[model samples]
Target: MWTLVLNCGSSSVKFALLDVQGGQVRLSGLAERLGSAGASARVEVDGARRVVDLAGGSYAEAFAVIAGALDELGVRAQVGAVGHRVVHGGERFSAPALITPEVLAEIRACVPLAPLHNPANIAGIEAAQAAFPDAAHVAVFDTAFHQSMPEVAFRYAVPGDWYRQHGVRRYGFHGTSHAFVAVRAADLLGRPLSELNLVTAHLGNGCSVCAVQGGRSVDTSMGLTPLEGLVMGTRSGDVDPGLHDYIARQAGLSLSEITAALNRESGLLGLSGLSNDMRELEEAAGRGHAGARLALDVFVHRLAKQMAGMAAAMGRVDGLVFTGGIGENSAWVRGAVLARLAVLGARVDEAANAAAVRGQSGVISAPGALAALVVNTNEELMIAQQTQTLLAEQKGVQA
Candidate 1:
């Protein structure tokens, strides 16, 4: 069976074709800068790659391009299912859902909670439905895995009405990544996921750390929104609530503008006054860019602080699994974070750390130290497998 995993952003579409039976990704690509003059798709089909210009295409057009690419690769008709990445499921969905009118409506109800992400998710789901009408379309939520978080770990120390009426509580993001890495970490450590207490950090442009105890997310750094986690490529994570009010009164800025700045104009970009790319920051930091160095320091320290907190949520640390772009590629970042995590007994082997980059997974910790492993995240594959599981359940029900 083949599955198509689709992740739709406001202006981009990321897709992967997985051979579910073969247990491998057959194709993957990204269509970015949609609704723009320079819109294009960078596609990888069976180890071969190419770029196709969309020439100012809409979201629907982007989906069309993706579907057309799959068709050219002769895998379109073989697509058994389509798994869509829906960012915020809120409290309504705790597992991957077979998308129906009712499930679609439930997802819509979550739009208010994720104004920036859910709308685009809906757009992708709707477009993928139209493109692959014959295939099963399932929604794999980013918030679903963290739904296991206990109340004490998720609840904010705020008013009850705000949480009861407005749903103002922690709903961590990057759940699929966290859940995927937890199991992978267990495999690397030669332990069962259900027997391990792990802290999995998904450190990309947007970063989050999760406390996985016995294969369930007990707690995570991100709360309610992705903006509440570690310092990201462009997001200011964990600011004092008073700053919002103070900045509003002093700078004469509206609450929305302040939020927009925090979400877009902050983090490494704001601190370095340069780029949000971690590779760029590392290079600039090496060349004596004080701002870049500060950004890296803050990012590393904040990550270590959160990792330590996540470890505190569990009984014992089996391993600290690093995934995502920065986690997988940056050896310096791994070393820096591990250095500060001495309290957690984290000690990295420099050779293993350097050798773990470029999508290779390895044990990076020193001999007999707390296990620090780099596990490459395969979210699309995770979505595909979840979609397949739901399909099997549906078949059993029908029979």
Candidate 2:
């Protein structure tokens, strides 16, 4: 069976057609810069690449282009199911769900929790459902894998009524990536996932850490929303809850303005007063840019601190697995984080750390150190697997 995975962002759509039986991507593409000048679509299959203009297009139009590309590649007929990546499942979904009208309504209800993501996800889901009505449609939630978290870890310290009434509590994101890497980390260590404890860090534009025990998420850094995690490219990670009120009173900033600043203008960009890209900050830091140096320092510090917290959650950290763009590629960042974790007996082989770049996965830990590794996260593949499982279950029920 072939599963078509669609990851819809605010302004871009990433897609992959995977052969679930063999775990291979038959085709992949991206449609980006929607509703803006130079909107475009690019597709690659069988080692061939093609790009087409989709200027000033919408998600619906983008999907139309993607469908055309699939047709051109001659794989449209092979797609047996369409898997949609829904960012927030709240406390409702613990696994991938077969999409129906009720399922779509539930997804729509999550828009408030993931205002910036769930709506886009719903748009993609609606578009795909319409485009491929004959095929099974599945909703693979990013929060589903973290739904196993115990109440002690997920509940806030605030009023119980707030959580009970408004559904306000820690619902970790990047669950699919965390779940994927935990299993992969176990495989790399030649151990069963059920036997190992791991602290998995996903460092990219958005960053979060997870503590996994016996293949289940015990604790995670992100809470309620993605804005609560480790410092990210443009999002402020952990700030005092009172800071919002203080800024509002002192600076006369509106709630929306404060939110915009935290979600867009802050983080490395706000701290460095420069680019948010880690590569750019690293280069600037090398040139003795104080802001860039400070930004990197703060990021590494927060990352190490949060990772230590995750380790505490697991009681004993058997291994540390790094994934995402920064985690996999930034040797400097990884080395610095590990250095701060020396008290935990975490030590990385300097040469190995430097060599594990550009998507290469390996054990970067020094001999006898507690298994620090670099693992590439395959979220699309994970979604495909979940979708396939759900579809098979649906078929069995029908039979």
Candidate 3:
């Protein structure tokens, strides 16, 4: 069986075709810069890469081109199911769900919570449904895993009416990535995930840390939105709530303008005034660039701080798992973070840390210390697995 996975964003759609039986990515592609003149898709089929120009910026246009490409490449006909990555499922869904009309409406209701993501998700789902009309469609939510969070961890210290009338509480993101890496971390330690307590740090362009207590998300850094997490490529993590009103009064900026900057122009980019890419910043810092050095320092410090808090939430740190782009490739980052985690008994083994870069996975912690692991994340595969389980549980041929 094959699962076609779609992770749609405001300006792009990432699609993948995976074989569940063999656990292979038969096709992977990204259609980016949608709603722009430079719209295009870069696809890799069976390990060969190619690029194709798209007709327009609309989701329909991009997916249409992709569908045609899939047909030409002879990969479309084998899709047994379709899995859509819905960013925010709110309190409605705790697992992958078959997309029914009522379920679609529930996803629509979450648009307000994820104005920039859920609508694009809906768009991709609709377009994929049109493209693979005969296949079973499942919605895998990014917030579903975090639903296990207790009220004390997820609720905010605000007015009761705020949460009662509107959905204004901590709804952590990056559920798929966290869930994927936690299982991998358990595998590395040769332990059952349900018997281990780990802190999973997903360090990518968008970053978040999860407190996995017994394979369940007990708490997470990203709250309500991706912007609330660790210092990301362009998103500030843990800013003072009063800063919004303070910036408005002092900087003469509107609420939306301030938010836009925080979501787009902040984080390592804002701190360094250079690039958000960690590799570039590291190079600049090595050249004694003060801003770049400061950015890296703040990133390491803030990330470790969040990791410590998450470890505290779990009450024990069996393993500190790192995944995503930076987590998988940056040995400097992994070592720096572990140095700060000494209080939790995390001591980095230099050779193991250095050897774990560039997609390599290993135990980087010193002997008799809190285990530090580097695990590669595969959200698309996890989505496919969830979609497969949901489809298997259905009666007759779900497609």
Candidate 1 structure quality by residue, lDDT tens digits, 1-399: 689899999889999888877877778889999878999888987898999888756877777777877888888888989999999999989999999999999999999899999999998888888888999999999999999999999899999999999999999999999999998888888888889999999999999999999999999999889999899999999999999999999999999999999999999899899989999999999999999999999999899999999898886887999999999999999999999998889899999999999989989999989999999998988888889998999999999
> Which of candidates 2 and 3 reaches a greater TM-score?
2
Q: What lDDT tens digits, residue by residue, belong to model 2 across residues 1-399?
A: 678999998889999988877888768899998778878888887668889788667887888887887787787887889988999999889999989999989999989999999988988888888888788999999899899999999999999999999899999999999999999999899999999989999999999999999999989999999999799999999999999999999999999899989999999999999989999999999999999999999999999999999999888989999999999999999999999999899998999999999989989999999889999999999999999888788879999
What lDDT score belongs to each candidate, Candidate 1 first? 0.92, 0.92, 0.91
TM-score of every candidate relative to the true structure: 0.98, 0.98, 0.97
Residue pairs with colliding backbones in model 2 are none
Query: Candidate 3, which segments miss by more than 4 Å at Cα?
Result: 396-399
lDDT of 2: 0.92
In order, how many clashes per candidate? Answer: 1, 0, 1
Ten contiguous residues with the weakest lDDT in model 2: 52-61
153-251: candidate 3 lDDT, tens digit per residue: 999999999988898889898899999999988888999989999999999999999999988999999887878978999998879999999999999
State the local distance difference test value for candidate 3.
Answer: 0.91
- CA shift at 390, candidate 3, in angstroms? 0.6
Question: Can you list the residue pairs that collide in candidate 1?
Answer: 171-224
